[model samples]
Target: MSELAVPAPSRHQLALMIWLAVFPTLTVLNLLLGGWLGDLPVVLRTFVLATIAVPIVVYGIVPRLHRLRARVLRGPHG
Candidate 1:
C-alpha cells in the first residue's frame, strides 16, 4: 500500500515555524523569569534562555506545528 508523503518545509517555512515557536516562548519565559534572569550578565542571560528555549521549541512546539501543517495540507477529509 502507498502512503502520502508530506514534503518537508522549505527554508523560509522552517524559519517562520521556528520563529513562531521561539518568539512567544522566549517572550513568556522572559516575562516569567525576568526578575531572576535580570541579575545575570547579558551573555549569560542569553545563554540560559537559549538553553531553556531550545529543547522546548525542538521537542515540544516544532513537532506540534509540523503536525498542524500536515493536517492543514491534508485538508478536512484527511
Candidate 2:
C-alpha cells in the first residue's frame, strides 16, 4: 500500500483547526436545539453537546478544513 506523506500541523494550527471546527458547530447546534437542551441539567446538556459535536467535527468539518488548508498551501499552481 502507498501512503501520502502530509506534514502534521503545529500545535497552534491544530488548535485553530479544532476551534474552527467546533465553534460554529456548537453555535448552530445550540441555536437549533437550545430550548430542548436548556431544560436539561448543565452536565447532561454538556454531555449531549459533546456527544453530538465530536463526531460532526471530527468526521465532517476537520477533513474539509484539512483539504482547504492543503489547497491553500498548494497555491494556484497546485
Candidate topping lDDT: 1
| Cα error of candidate 2 at position 44, Å | 0.1
lDDT per residue for candidate 1 within 1-78, as digits (tens), equals 454668999999999999999999999999999999999999999999999999999999999999998888877867
The true-versus-predicted C-alpha distance at residue 14 of model 1, in Å, is 0.7
**lDDT of all predictions:** 0.94, 0.90
**What is the TM-score of each predicted model, taking all chains together?**
0.93, 0.90
Per-candidate alpha-carbon RMSD to the true structure: 1.5, 2.6
Residue 64, candidate 2: alpha-carbon lDDT: 95
- The 10-residue segment of model 2 with minimum total lDDT is 1-10
Candidate 1: worst-modelled 10 consecutive residues by lDDT? 1-10
Question: What TM-score does candidate 2 get on C-alpha atoms?
Answer: 0.90
